[model samples]
Target chain A: MRFYESKTAPASKGDLTPMIDMTFQLIAFFMLLVNFTDAEQDQRVRLPESILAVPPDEPYEERLTIQLASKDVIIFAGSEFSSLDQLSRALLVEKQILEAREKKVSDTTIIIRADRESKTGKVQEIIQACQTLEFLKFALRGKQAEVRVRSPSN
Target chain B: MRIRHAGREDTTELQMTPMIDIVFQLLVFFVMTFRIALPEGDFSIQMPSASASATLEPQTSPTLQVRLKARADGELTSITLDGTSMSDFTDLQQRIRRIVRDSAGPGESGSDREVEIDCDYHLKYDYVIQAITAISGYVDPETRTPHKLIERIRFAPLQK
Candidate 1:
């Protein structure tokens, strides 16, 4: 009779510790997975498909990456170089400094990563700037094509 | 006197305000920084469909690869070919022709030579077609016939 009376008594409190822990876990998962998209988003550009489109063997060295956005050419190389002429001069100065220090200029490769909608002239400007600076080695970056699959019903 | 004497009860409380504030701040930070994945422009390029067989054979020597950037105002800008910029289109064409003519076999002429063009993905279809037409004149074998026997035309995606 005493055991039955104790079991029938109402619970004292609601345990919210589990709920709080679960919420924190969910927040942490989202925090780890978030990837920030930038202003130079290539939304309208459509790329050519290629079977040979493979990822780099390993991560490439940090090189100059120029992005041709709609209105402006964004030069992303640790610091942003807005003017083409200025960028060219800067590159030239860097080359000269490197040559003086090492007795030979390093083949610092330039990577052009342009948006599809960006004007070709802008991309050319970047190339011309690099050439003026004597930074000859260049790599045009591209994304691999996705394989499309048809529904089983079709 | 005995009833007045009493023992004190122990009390404990967990301060969750600071922890909740930190969690909320983290949530906001993630929400602001979260970027939606997008397909790059090069991957979505619509290559002209053709029935030609895929050629896996490598070319004997490196050839100048030209990429033309067409402006919205109908201006054409030439970019680097494999990263090396040419002086100008006219200069580039003349140099290519001379190189091809000089490097050809005894029987082969300028007509048998070929050059590859990787047009910007954003360039208008008409501009590319026009550029190809213009380039054909520079490579024509004979003065009378303007037909350029271009060895191949390959659509290369713009690198991101």
Candidate 2:
């Protein structure tokens, strides 16, 4: 019997060090640069799109995030508040926290990240609630650059 | 330990089983949880509070109200600028520019102007953004300047 009639040379071991090193680098990249999204923004909510949207300028100084999930459902910091009144109370607590750090809550640039499906007036009511609480400065958030939208005046 | 024959294929090898397993697991986790879209903009608007009413100089600068009336399906049916119905966004822009030109100086464009957006109860946010883009003048590619038809924009009381 010719069990090992036509035999090739024994194979050398392949080095996995390079593969492991490259994999680790990729993992590190995702870990460091991946979006660690804020608690105020729920990824499930589809945001509205706008070509005019741009990041807020500093010296508007302290900022607060208020998410309007629906007309009744709102969230700020970490707690979900059902009513605008409740949301403002939570905002008040946050203002105190900021004031403890010598920051002015009044100077805060409030970002309203309402869902695309939510009514505009729901967002407006949240603004009214914030306004009633004296947190008057506001900003509306939208998904930026969906189109290279040509503005009428641009 | 058994000695290998010289020039025979050195059997010693890097065991990649564990490393591949861990790497694949990490890849799966990030791939599933990765968020593609990011919130990149905070278009600023301000409301004049009763306490800080004096600093806004409302008397010096008239507030232009942009009214957006929407249908039950949350689409805008009409856009009116201070009771005058605008034909389209272009007309809206022209009227706003004229408003700014009348009050604003060469260097003081829209400094003294204020804009109030009166949105209906059921309007979708898309139309609001469209309205904002229309009234909030475009960026001047010429001088790389952001031309402001009005710097101060506030939402008016929501009408049912």
Candidate 3:
């Protein structure tokens, strides 16, 4: 007696479509999270201290940084202004320019980095100048003081 | 029937290219808006802490202001009261006591006389505390009585 055998064809395809879709999603997630620093910025000022201080952990875009050095007030995006009046004008111009180009200005903020040893009068002047230009929001930069431990000699 | 069988095994593909592009765009937007804040220095003063301290009432006019400058030799070289220079610490102490005493009434509290102390940044911590102690009621070592003269001492940073 002879036995009859049946032959079956194997599945031809393994799908890579799901993997490609997942890879694309991952790429998108990282792309949305990356923050880019503006090139025309300057941040070289000593900050004041407090009893409770935390390091800043924000992304760097959409900020206008103002750096106050020993003698001059430097605008990060534009030219340095020697006086508060000049800085005010430059701020106004920049604000208008940004609004005109972007058609929106709600998210922009100003950052003031003044040296810790600088006078309060100067810092107030800068604040007043910014207020006049309608740049009401500001972030004051400051460093966390280092803690020291005392060892007792018995 | 033949056409229906041919369509049964058809596979549909979803393109993720546009979704990926939009996600990258949002990431770039957030990254561009990130701000790194620099430190601000001036007027960041470490005030000496006191548990028994009370806040002062607002002054209608400028109170008596005393400016104390500490020299490199660890001595208070100059003392100015309300823009007028005083010759010695004794004189400064006397002036403060007189102002506080004159301001207080018989039944009124001594908190009205506010003394503002403008200290130099380079001054030693001990010197600052000493100045504060002096401005407030000084305790006579011999009599051991705390004279309730000056009511409050305000610490102001020196203006550059």
Candidate 4:
């Protein structure tokens, strides 16, 4: 009997260089756009739009973000308060903390993020509460509106 | 002549499994953590407490008061600038621009112009912002540059 030799070709491998290159490009894009800072933007509050609402030249050194959700709910420091009294109490405590840290409560800006549908009075109440706590500086947050050029005739 | 192979060809295989796995992991992590942050800005208002304001002497420039009225459903019903009814925020802006231009002194930049917003309790917050936007500044129609009408804005005392 004669012995026959068997021949087998090596399995083909798809090119991974292009895929790897594309993936690396994607990674770089995301890395460049990734924001690591706490934006203090809560999903519950939809900020009103303003064309003049430009970002500050420099970020405030110390700031407190108070979000006013719809239906009079105030979110501060990750906690939700449904009433002005509760929020005031929390702000009083915040004032004490700032004082303990040797930080001027007046120097710390109070940023108000109020939902579009939320009552204007609630925003005023939050500001009043902050004022009571000696937070004189208040920043009303609004999303930057898309620029639409108006005709001089109009 | 005797055949002598001085050097033999060596095929070295690189281990790609570990590197590919790590790269995939990093991609997945970034994809999961990716979030698009919206561009936000602030309208800063420096308001002292009522008591503090009381201590300071009254100002020479008259305060421009804007009153916003809303219906039961929290929609803007009407807007009034210094007791004068405004058709809309556009009208308010025009009137403000005229006032600022007329009252501006030679050296004055109109930054001293102040507007007080008095809004109804049930009014939607959107209208307040619109009023503020109208009262605070306006973009030049031809140049597209923003011009300040009033830099100082404060809300009126909270009403029940």
Candidate 5:
């Protein structure tokens, strides 16, 4: 096998402008990607509204939101979990992070934004997962004062 | 940042290799995590919570238990407010309002009667929300505020 040497070829400068541009673009992309983590939530679930439901004014010290959708789908922080074990395991990791940060595990509130049509059992299951992790604080999400039609009269 | 070739070479070239490698890694990370369309959950919503064994304040007021029974297909079969069965959500709403009125009668300080929602495991959440709506009266759309029948509401713990 003959290997051609480029020693005789004219020394040329490959433009680094594109690489720099692409890198900047990527950095910007990931920066925006992470800044907007809320974009990954499943939108199919319609939230229930309550007159008493108030929007939180204070930022969470540390928070995790769980979205429960129809057909038994449980999504945590943008990843889907099919079983309670998976959900618990993932929650344990979050618990450890809080622990390492010198924060109390129970202080980490798990926000549940379940679809209005989702099974209560499923929502309960997610709560149980948080409870198992010793994270007792919870925030259940509902829209504020939504006008909904009453159930059909029999 | 560019490095100068030591003594003889006059050319100054930008250090592209390392920067390019790092950029690719970042691009890959962002691409892997990019989700094209996830629209909702933009604004946060807050809900009131109650513990299973939480005792009622102003103990004279009864804790209303709204039980929802469902068929195998997830259709709501019955909604009983404290064992009195009702046909639909409106009936449940009326009964709940009446109970609230009685508990916190006029010419008296409103009673903070607690409500516990106990739902069948297989029931669709639509009905549960409906029951919640029934118990939680809507705002007069024009007024944007409606008095709640029961101020303290919580989920009933499953019977183990």
Candidate 6:
């Protein structure tokens, strides 16, 4: 009888309000800090560092991002092209799309995210491909370095 | 009557299971999608097509050419600014500063000064960027402000 009485007693419930409040705070914190602009950054290319590589005051009106993963591979719009001929064809399609929208092809900035180890000639070739398409503005992207590159007088 | 009061109080207890489940799911979703991005910047340059460049009239100031020599293994060997050999990128920056200071009088901007980067075929792209960084500008260590050196930058024809 004693065992039955002890087993039938109501269980204790501690306060859950504080835990719920803390979890809600954590959720709010994470929601405020989440970013979705990292889609353009690829893991294959490690950009060269430059102290003078400061973000532009105003973002370009229209921009196309092209990444060079290796000497033989170029990534544009998540598609890989091995040769300049293929890349040129892709760029032509993009130009046609821009023209269809009544947009000036020259106004679109080409952002080159070439690997630090890639060949310079390959980058120039990429530029030549864009040039052939009448895209004039080129923005060479680089990782920001914190080191001080002071002037000679200093 | 006492048992009825106790049952009424039990019925008033909050239902927290569903709310907690949804909150945890949201937290997990955010945690899974969180990404830390490194700050990046650009060096903007405008280059016209070869045919267009040929038709354009020559400027009053000559385009200063900086040549980068590289080894078979794709390492930078030497830097030359307008046919004058430079020991390193720092030296190149000094020479450019002197030229800009002398050419541009008081309150004149360096926009008219142009620089052309001529890189070897097999050179690593990083060295070319280093050259561009040195030619474009320098950051003041004291104020962390970037001072512009040359605004106009163009790449030379690719060397075979």
Candidate whose lDDT is highest: 6
- Candidate 1: where are CA atoms >4 Å away? A1-14, A35-54, A77-83, A90-107, A149-154, B1-9, B37-115, B118-160
Candidate 2 structure lDDT: 0.75
RMSD of 4: 3.8
- What digit string (tens of lDDT, one per residue) describes model 3 on residues B1-160? 4456665676888766686677566656655665654332211122222321335345665677888776654356788999989887567777877766644333434445667777665443334434444555444444333455554565663353
Winning model by TM-score: 4
Regions of model 2 farther than 4 Å from truth:
A1-12, A37-39, A70-72, A146-154, B1-29, B102-111, B139-146
Order of models, best lDDT first: 6, 4, 2, 5, 3, 1
Query: Which segments of candidate 6 are over 4 A away from where they belong?
Result: A1-4, A149-154, B1-12, B102-108
* Candidate 4 per-residue lDDT over residues B41-80, each given as its tens digit: 8998868898888897787789999999989789998999
Candidate 3 residue-wise lDDT at A91: 76
Model 5: CA > 4 A from native: A1-37, A44-54, A57-59, A143-154, B1-60, B102-111
B1-160 per-residue lDDT for model 1 (tens digits):
4665357656678777788788878877777766665433221111222222234345576655667765555456665555677656456545555555543333333344345567654463334433333343332232222223233443453442
Instruction: Predict model 1's lDDT versus the native.
Output: 0.50
Q: What's the candidate order when arranged by decreasing DockQ?
A: 4, 6, 2, 5, 1, 3
lDDT of 5 by residue, B13-131 (tens): 66778877877887888778776542222222122234523552455756788898877777788889889999898798778777767443223433367778887887876676667
Cα lDDT, all candidates: 0.50, 0.75, 0.55, 0.86, 0.69, 0.87
Better of 3 and 6 by TM-score: 6
- Shares of reference contacts reproduced by the candidates, in order, are 0.16, 0.68, 0.07, 0.80, 0.29, 0.86
lDDT of 4 by residue, A1-154 (tens): 9887886878998888898898888888888787768556788889899998889999998999999988788999889988889889888999999999999998999989999999998888889888878899999999999778776678
DockQ of each: 0.12, 0.49, 0.09, 0.72, 0.23, 0.67
Q: Tell me the docking grade of candidate 5.
A: incorrect
In candidate 6, how many Å is residue B110 off? 2.8
How far does residue B125 in candidate 1 sit from its true spot (Å)?
Answer: 11
Which should have the higher TM-score, number 4 or number 6?
4
Model 1: number of backbone collisions: 13
**Which prediction has the highest DockQ against the true structure?**
4
Q: After superposition, how far is residue B46 of candidate 3 from its true place, in Å?
A: 17
Docking class of 6: medium
